[model samples]
Target: MSRATVLACLVSSSVLALTVAAASPAQAAGVDYVALGDSYSSGVGAPGQSGLCLRSNYSYAAQWATRNSPATFQFLACSGAETDDVLDSQVPAMKSGADLVSITIGGNDAGFAPTVLTCLTSSDATCTAKVNEGKAYVANTLPGKLNATYTAIRNKAPGAKVVVLSYPNIFDTSAALCEMSMTKRKAINSGAQTLDDMIKARATAFGFTFADVRGNFTGHGVCAARPYLNGLTIIPPQNSYHPNANGYTLGYLPALTSAVS
Candidate 1:
């Protein structure tokens, strides 16, 4: 069966970390590793996906696989996935005997992208109202959902070292744009802080290493000398607001690598 099928369909919930226990450590190859998350982890702004999982080989997880040369690697991150999606379905990939796991979720739960769009399409006050709803969701609803998902991952893959990754502050306060107002940009960044902090706290609470990439995207946000994130574009609407190749390579990859070893 294809890797995506195995991760999303074939594996039963009853199966714990299946392959992780018998892994031959004496071999030169490393342990079985799996990547799971939303658009950020799926490389939505990179080149198109090569599989049904919405995973691009240029993603940070794929890059990490190339650099580390793990015994086996599965890039199962799908774009638009929320915390519930991972908890309900993606947990199948956290098979027994798996060695390492990394994920970037919670933004979708916070209605992040939609809030940004609401700001663009409507009034600043209207946008803030919607964004506030999302923020409240993150604060109140997301924690319990995140904890359940994190705990499921730990239970499903007891042997694996889970690494929960953070999203960057996609906006640059200094930038001026016709697409939206500065107030919305700042509001979105404020929401980003809330999401990141919550994810960080929940991740560390579950004993997973939370990799923060805010530092990497510091000056390279949507407005900088050179932006790591994409601005509104008509050419490819799907990749909008996500990290481009440079962001994945220079920003996320370095941070993820350092966090692992």
Candidate 2:
């Protein structure tokens, strides 16, 4: 080939390569992302799960990692983890060079599991009492526990942009035809809101970003026509009140992506 023709071809090739590289997804920057927290983060209700932790490829964390193609990803969140569990087990796996970290904790710690169970199987008054108990714990005690967990995360992954995710209100009180009493549903949702508010405050105090999934999940609670969260299931009882696969894909995935991006 003539020298002039060869030089022109080389220039075009270089320009094409640069354009393709520039158009790549933001995650191509080699992010080291860690997913830490409890059942919600572990994808309990969603499918593609295994072992005691119930880690699912469908979980928001896994989906995010898959789409972004991060340099490294550790899905350490477990089904029944509390703040203490995070401090003792999950946080230990996190390293200093991590570029991103996401968590969904405090629900199990506030005893939402048993509270919801009570609401599902008991009278409206009884459900209200149990929900009140959870609210009391959230108001008076969960802050300290959350603070400890958040602090440990900051220390472990100093450079990571931590996104603290909040839980969705479990029920749709507005649903016209539903089995759960409106009173019970409202009480349970109120408890979740209280917990979320507290979590947002603590996350902000730590200078971490708080991703509220409630807005994404507003019309998609348990009683909705297309519910993202599971109502109750006897076979795998742990899945109860947790987000379904759609919830992770639609409700949570976007929330985390928005927070990090």
Each model's TM-score?
Answer: 0.86, 0.89
lDDT of 1: 0.77
Provide the lDDT at 78 for model 1: 85
Rate residue 67 of model 2 by lDDT. 74
Q: Write the per-residue lDDT of candidate 2 for residues 1-261, one digit (tens) a residue.
A: 443443332222110011111112564458888999988999888887898787999898988887778888888999888899999998887867788899999988888767766776689999999999989999999999999999999999888899999999889878977768899889988999999999999999999999999998889999898899887655455666788988988889889978887
Identify the candidate with maximal TM-score.
2
